[model samples]
Target: FVFADVIGQIVELTPIEVVSANGKETHKLTVELRNEKDERLPMVLWGNFATDVSDAIQGRGENAIICVLRFGKIKVWKYERSVLNAYNVSDVELNPLTPEVEAFASLLSSVYIVMCTIAAIESDMGCYYLSCKVCSKKVLNVPNDNIDEQGDEDEMGFHYYCVKCKVKNPRLMPRYKLHLVVLDNPGNSKFLLFDAIAMQILNRPCNELTGSNFEEMQDPEDILLALKDLV
Candidate 1:
């Protein structure tokens, strides 16, 4: 799709994450932009754009302002449409005093960002889940599947299937999904930290703590130790 501008309130902001794409490590952050009409669209900010937005949210502690994206491109994955910034060509602005923002200023309200402390590990629910390396979606093993030409089954069980991507023997990765109780000003509340936030808090990715083999469950000792250290 053609590059265009998108302005909305930033909501559901994820921590800045470093991921490997095309053999290069890059920073990325995912966020939802909510318009005045309450329509929300998912958008991903990569490289400097990711760090810039994360820094703004950290410094402001509120997400109620308008975000301006210039030259952002639309991306579709599995029939879901989202926005992504065009490399080197896109620009990002948080709370710019533009005419467009001033026109819709009255319709927007600041959303408070909450700060919580980790109280304790809620359960032994494990630390991560197996997901497709391509799309980061959960995948299932295909039974009686033929081995790839590389004969991966002997090394690591092969033939996992992604229902969404519709691929066989797809590469896999481990993603964090921790169950914990967090304490904030109000009270203790249960919080489930998925891969993005969990990696940010843990200072490491799930792959660092576990293996990619779906049939073999990795020892959660490292993950548990990290969680205990946080408490």
Candidate 2:
């Protein structure tokens, strides 16, 4: 089957890796694209095209991208259904010029990007969850002392482990997690601001805030004062 053009959102992206193809090893980047109706199709890109697309998104630190692919041939696996393969002739267009993509911009324009004044900060919800910097995952604190052969006494040492990354580290980082009641001309509503926004509001990093006087961070007034200009 040949599709001259296809439009979809990248629902899943796989890391570029060397895989066995036709009994030979080659780098492959596989992605699952979803249409507006939620139908998904797997597409494979080889070598440079695969590495470029994968690196471009990773460098920008974006989760995913919607794109349009022009011309591809369908290939069927032994046990699986058909999937699309891109060759030298195929062209990829990001945020392509199409009615489907234009609709997204239209929706964005229709919605207002208003900044609301925070009426209340729910600091009680915890300013942040203790996380590991490398993985951005909640870390589990544990005693650093190694258990003896006979499960003996507790010694002086402590560290944290990141379950998501499946690694142990000597320290954990703090990332802000806040819930606030924000006021706008429309009215007041609760808004949850995660780590990124909170960092901008405080003008301090996750490490600094957690390392020094952590208790002072509990006061919402200090945070609101710093956010006066932003909101």
lDDT of 2 by residue, 1-231 (tens): 656566667656644555567887656778887765566688778766676666565454543467677787666577554445466777876666778787743443232376777787776565566766775645655565665433222332545566446687624667767777789887787766667767877777756745644232545555634444444
For all candidates, the clash counts are 1, 0
Best model number under lDDT: 1
Candidate 1 — what's its lDDT?
Answer: 0.74
RMSD of each: 10.9, 11.4
- Across 122-179, the per-residue lDDT of candidate 1 in tens digits comes to 5456667777888666666544444444565534544566654678867888787777
Worst 10 residues of 2 by lDDT: 148-157
The list of candidate 1 runs beyond 4 A from truth reads 109-231
lDDT of each: 0.74, 0.62
Error of 1 at 119 (Å): 20
- TM-scores for all candidates: the values are 0.50, 0.43
| lDDT accuracy of residue 95 in candidate 1 | 86
Q: Identify the leading candidate in terms of TM-score.
A: 1
The superposed Cα distance between candidate 1 and the true structure at residue 173, in angstroms, equals 26
